[model samples]
Target: MTNNKTSEVPVQDPGADAVSESVIQLIRQHYTLDARRIRRIYAGLGSRNWVVYTPQETYFVKEFISSEDAQKGKRSIEVATHCITSGIASPSTVANRAGEHLTLLEDGGLALFSYVHSDEQIDKFSIDMMAAAGVNLADTHRALSRYTAPGEDETDEWLDMDVAEIVETVDEILGEISKLDQTSEFDEVSRRLLQDRKVQLANYSRLIEPIRILTRGVIHGDYGQKNLIVDDTQCLWVIDFGSADIFLPAYELGRAAFPPENFDHDDWLDRGLSMIKSYALRGALTRQNLVFCARAWLVQLLQSVYGVKQHYLKPHELQEDLDLFWLRRGKATATLFESLEEVEASIERIL
Candidate 1:
């Protein structure tokens, strides 16, 4: 289902002309720069990114998908600023003439930032790179330790899944699966995966309580090789705080070590231990933290299985292609879940 096409210039979307005009006007009015070219970058989820080339310099423009994300975008900028001040390599937000980080757009919000010339090659990440990623994340955590949100009552969209919420979600998914015809392989796999996850949730329900007592902080919600950018100078820069949230450090560490998608490497256990060691040098990681890490990994797999099931249930133009995609993902999740005990044991030994 993935496209393998590579082009120097991105193909224009249907509204490219109108969007280009609006971008130009926004830039001229606010930043006082004339845009020469604007090309869309379709990499991340939920946001429309465009790389704008102006006569002065190149910049990155991010357009939020919803109005609510406008506030989140602003907060991300604030957190990134704090990270940069704490000596972490992060992109700096470019304020407008009015000294505002966010610009109101017709549908949502737009923010401009200095374009970072970095490469995000997740498949090419070596153990050394993983260790470096771990160290970078630790530094980020240390920098963000003192951060206090401007609004005390603000809700984070990237909250960790709790036992009650997970149970409720599984119940809803089971109900939806029961209504399905189950004629296709995708449907069968969905039902099986959901059933397996429900059992896993019940078995691991006790770990969630102790996780609540662990050290908490603001963390990069979507920490992974893809979100990490290795610049031309080989300095690693963390990007995309769209999913930033305040949660137990163990959850972040676990999510970072065990991403939803499987990688090409087979030595994940070693790489994960290296990351944990590097992070432990800067922060704390108790045995309970490792337990929470395993639980977090299971939670992410459950979410992935649910997401793929939902996609399969919904009628899509590329349902035929997506059938294979979801099937492979389901199989991978099942395989990982079956051998999760080994991974957890390894983490425990390291701790």
Candidate 2:
């Protein structure tokens, strides 16, 4: 649940267009591909993306804005390739004419992927897809567990946090949001949520419990709505094996199954546990592996303020972005903090 790396590129991201003459030439020459049409799509931060159509088929293209992102994208491509070979339901990477995942560019880089079509949103929380999501995530973890990326020994996903420092950061952002003019809707909502979170942070310490037994491995970095597409048959297609190097099952399960939208549902806990239990059954995991989940997620929610910084502090850097996502996440964090005791008790009883 960590924030993305800070990119040092220009504010004018190359997210506008990829169908220019020179770019088309690079795509055709290196990958021997012709684009019938290219439409820009938002995949994630740090990339210019397009859902493209060719005379033959459809595909997705991602172009990174910086060298650092390009390199991480390459590694993720490697991991996705491995996932496909291991029988995971991920899109296959298309190599350029030179037989590499990336077609390197002057300022950034581009990569192509087979297209995935979906008829549903995970927001609907369809009964069939929830269980499928669990199995999909479990299978992904099982496959990545055996894979160690190039020049890597071991990876740990446990968050390193100081309670006081996080509280202070929260306080700082809250105070900053307080001084806003409140003319905009985001400013109004953010101010109220910050005030609520400040009160909740006082008791957040009660949720803390120390742990020693830890398990860590490669993780599917982003398993949320953006990457998970439910096709017409309702099979969960996991995509975009992000630059995630390490993860803990407890944190990720809470992150994936207990989405922000689920908090509003009356049976949120049941749905979350259903997904987690399904994952555990498919992956053959034990109770101890998931025991610390409540604490793991609690700490993460406490640390979340990426939205605050993006909205209130660095507004200039903002583009056509996921504004609703940040607000939903902030609201969910408040709900969880208010219900910490029930959340922890439920996880303990079930797991």
Candidate 3:
């Protein structure tokens, strides 16, 4: 969901040099910052981030990439605020002097936040951290429940999508790849992966024909390792509510608990178990939630092909390595999808 399209705003610098003059003016006017330091930072999934320094405090600035629907931006910040008010340990979006969460740019939006200090970059988390993340997500789900509930039409938005149409999309992607110059091995691997995509996508549909009805709600859509940060005290601060949408909580839980990178890890099962037990401590997860996560997860991995499309077709918009990152994750997920029943039963054991 985060790896979708690109949006154009009136900005030039893409690196650590300096923010555009218009953005600087916006900062000065909206934020009332004098002569402090500002520098761009490396953040992905379609948003640009910066760290602003001042005499009293440090602040984090984020540039919303898409402005086509400004209401979406409003809803995202509202969700983030709701998450914080519900006692979730997340970075809070600070309102401007005029009491607005979002300051729309010429074609995009700008938001200022209280900077979260994180001294460590967690590559892999321990079981305790896993459980903590699970509990945090549960708390977040419960928090969002107060703001709004997802509508009935949105329940099948993910589940009822036609696999055949997705296969056709894959074919179009393949045809585009075939026309490329084929510079390196990544190009070759992409071609092979798309071939896998067409067949397995149909097979996946047949195997899980009647996708189970899932627990539906508006959630922190991209709740993965990338969006999670660890501070000096080892507390996990969930960030990035821009991709917030209607989704199955268990589907998201399954992806986080049994991610493809850790699917074959020796303690993968135990780690997932810890997460589930922690989440279910307050009975946030249902029996249907437990049973359908794997199937939904498989569908997500196969069908969420925007990252691949952006990387291959729209080359300059994303990093070159993103193709490999997504392709590898997709392949691993397909391998795990073959054992979907085992995964379902294993996770259901905690139920």
Query: Candidate 3 local accuracy as lDDT?
Result: 0.70
Clashing pairs in 2: none
Q: Candidate 3 has what TM-score?
A: 0.85
TM-scores of the candidates are: 0.80, 0.85, 0.85
lDDT of 3 at 285: 73
Tens-digit lDDT track for model 2 on 1-351? 011332222213465343443445566778877765555664478776766566898877787888888987888888888888888877788889999888777777999888877764344465455667778888888888777663332232233446567667767777786676655777778778777767766765555444235466667777765677767666667777865566566667778777887776887777777777677778545676665665566667766767566665575244335466678778778777777568767766765
| Candidate 2 deviant stretches above 4 angstroms | 1-23, 121-124, 150-158, 181-183, 203-206, 316-322, 348-351
TM-score between candidate 1 and the true structure: 0.80
Could you give candidate 1's per-residue lDDT for residues 74-161 as a string of tens digits?
7788878877888989778888878888887667788998888864444425667777877888888777676766323112333345
| Model 1 error, position 153 (Å) | 9.3
When 1 and 2 are scored with lDDT, the better candidate is 2
- lDDT, candidate 3, residue 37? 60
In candidate 2 the C-alpha lDDT for residue 146 amounts to: 70
Candidate 1 Cα outliers beyond 4 Å, as residue runs = 1-17, 120-124, 150-188, 207-210, 242-244, 303-306, 312-336
